[model samples]
Target: MYKNKYEPALDIYRRTLDNQLKLIHGDHRDIAASLSGISWALGYIGHTEEALEYSMQSLAIQQRCTPSYHPMLAHTLRAI
Candidate 1:
């Protein structure tokens, strides 16, 4: 099933996000990247609301930490 295929990926993304949060004190590109990973996994798993939330969070972090023209920001925007 689609859920079975993506569930493991979602779990990994969540764990990675947790680790990134613990290691990084504030908004960082790594954190944003983790969030984006989670968002992608969640979206594939059919958790659209949560996916959008994570995508927004990632976008916010990217906007704050990276240049406005950063590829990551553009990616997050497209994801949202």
Candidate 2:
């Protein structure tokens, strides 16, 4: 039941990430946010390894694009 709920969400998050990657040329906050969303969905679906990977990717982007004290960086770190 839980898996059923998260699976569709996971698919949507993946599609969003893909679209963001296509539309945006470089590392951007929106892409990082999308990656974070995908990470959250993957974590909820028990795909912890994949979730961690996405989370780390998000963190890296956030670090590069955002200030050191940015809230998004903290959020991504927490997710990691």
Please, what are the lDDT tens digits per residue for candidate 2 over residues 1-80? 55457778888888998888889999899999989988998898799999999999999899899999999999888777
Model 2, residue 66: distance off in Å is 0.4
Q: Candidate 1 regions off by >4 Å?
A: 1-4
TM-score of each: 0.91, 0.89
Q: Candidate 2, which segments miss by more than 4 Å at Cα?
A: 1-4
Steric clashes per prediction: 0, 0
All candidates' lDDT scores? 0.89, 0.89
RMSD, every candidate, angstroms? 2.3, 2.2
Q: What shift in Å separates residue 77 of candidate 2 from its native position after superposition?
A: 0.7
